[model samples]
Target: MRFLSGREAVLKHIFETDDEAPLTPVAVTVTVTREGRTTAATSGTAIRNGDVYTFAAGSLPLGVYTVRWDGGTAAVDTSWFEVVGGHLFTVAEVRAYDADLSADRFPTSAVVRLRDYIAGEFESITGRSFVTRCRRIPVELDGSCSPLPLVDVQATTFEDSAGQTVYAVSVEPVGPFTLAEGEGSYTAELTYGFRSVPDDVKRAALLRIRTLLFAERSGIPDRATSFQPAEGGTYTLATPGVRGSETGIPDVDAVLGRYGFDVLDDLAGVLL
Candidate 1:
């Protein structure tokens, strides 16, 4: 299961005996862990509601969390959940696109998985980062103009080899337009990536997600091909798979075509 960050996570488990009857243990305990570190734990009979045990894990940061339920039974039930800062599309947005979709028929977890999958696929196909990030990168300056091999550059601060801020540097639309009067190595505190994802990109992602869901629920393989005989021709229908930089969906492919670029194109053949 997955949840957005800053949202409370409610974990529940049903206890049953070997005879297929409700079994309420004398006591139940819940433990929440992240990266093998226990973050929260609770033990008591207060957590039990009849045969159902629940633990309300408070708002957690972005990361995977494991939940363990110890009901004094011979077996320990374990489950996992994830928290993300944001997604390209929200569950509400996805449901808006498909009016027939409902929480009962299609859960939010399934939708989150599909959204995450499409987001990753879009980034991989376009060779671009959609999430804003900051990092320190090594750069070589020739005392003049030097292009920073990064995309969607928002801001940068250049520092000399000794890690001192270089005041004699100016950032241009493309990269560092000017640098200090010397040839040497420098580090750049670069902040880059999109503040908001493109509308068309989100639309393409929605379409692809819808296609996948429809195929899955209808028992149809996405890659399955069928041929129909017409009065004067044969029509072949098939779903396109990801090839090269294409997503196989017409609208998706069109959107990606506008943003996709070869690695060489991104670097402009600059070795650095």
Candidate 2:
């Protein structure tokens, strides 16, 4: 007797003696195959006459697969599934060994902790208070639910970076913002108390941001455009990803000093 359960695929098999006779505890081996690709095999103990065998989900991923069993008796049963995750990041949605975020493993329990850490770091770097409402929207395409659950994470704050305080009074996103399906962007209103940002500084920071946001990202265009806000508000960019926003930290300082507040810096604080 055998038991099997899964989503994408299912398997059926049994372990018994010849002629339904009671068999001594026999060693059973089960091999699973998917799309002609042989996955690993598992071993089990024989289910004596009228006995039951259970191999709960410690093995196998979500997908179509075939299960073959041989209890030293004969090649008896097979099964398959469409569960999810091909293996690691495919179904998991979140992965620990992300080179970009440099996260260890995708841990669900620490979302807020991660966000808080970013907020704290932002305050430390900019010397400003961040009053924000953080929301994580799970991203999904093809109807496959995200393991990460929340895909679109948004954190809005009035915190001023060392640059925004001087170069710009404020900036805000125009009302009626929109996001196209399968895309991401953020918008904000901006105000500049200064005459205008120096072209050299603006170009330098914009270059850094563009490089940071889209460097590893794919599917979007190789280039992007960023506009300086006339007033103090949100600096927004719609990219291939689900969102794009700004710390309103002027890039002017980036030219004067190290470009710490560029996209790389912001992501380091936020990617957590």
Candidate 3:
């Protein structure tokens, strides 16, 4: 429920010739572009600190920025990072899952990193995440109505393709409603995902981490297969039933079914 911004970046200059060597070259140009327009331009000396180059030119704006470095000894390379929130689960939560597995606790330094990896895996499997963060999300409202994947909407404005603000007004609750027709485009700044992690989602995450720990101990690949019957007849009704897993892991899928499954998103529409 907290909003955050004003992140800084520090760029490092490492020589390819020697991995440990630091070289400060001439004519360094750092250009920062956000959304599309160039917001900050600075020379090398302003950001240089011995071998390291920091974006101390100014505080980076809240949105995504494209940082470009050039005229250095290395090739013209570009990289990016977002000023985002912390992970969904704390080290304690991750360690609790570890305790459930009877595995030794990971080092404190590695706990956050491990939690991040596990959270990524959970999102990959469930098609959703537990933590909410602010983002400029592009919304397509073409009259096909569905629940917006937002916990809360901060601001929304309709706009045309030419980047001009359209004059139609929208009122909350902003989602799970159909947009009126003939409105070409719109964008919403929303705080998406859950404010607090759901209990079922946490259970699924713990089970998944347990599966991984068991696999690590046993030295087998962390993969499993499961099956479910096709609709229209019970498996015991003397009818041939299809076999497959909704998400390959039964416990995880059972929890996700209540929170994350989207039948329409996975459905293949009929074709002529």
Considering every candidate listed, which one attains the maximal TM-score?
1
Candidate 1 lDDT (Cα, 0 to 1): 0.67
By TM-score, rank the candidates, best first. 1, 3, 2
For model 2, the superposed segments whose C-alpha errors exceed 4 Å read 1-25, 39-49, 57-59, 85-272
lDDT of 3 by residue, 93-122 (tens): 766665653335446445444555666665
Candidate lDDT (C-alpha), each: 0.67, 0.34, 0.50
Q: Please give, for residues 79-110, the per-residue lDDT of candidate 2 as tens digits.
A: 55333221111112223223333234324334
Better of 1 and 2 by TM-score: 1
lDDT of 1 by residue, 1-272 (tens): 65666688777777656799767776777788763244463333327777778778878754567777776654467777766555677899989998877788779878877877776687777766564444467877777665666667676777776667886666666331222244577777766556677788778888988887776675544565544445666544434553433655677788888886675554554434
My TM-score estimates for the predictions, one after another, are 0.57, 0.22, 0.55
Candidate 2 has its poorest 10 consecutive residues by lDDT at: 185-194
Clashes of 2: 46
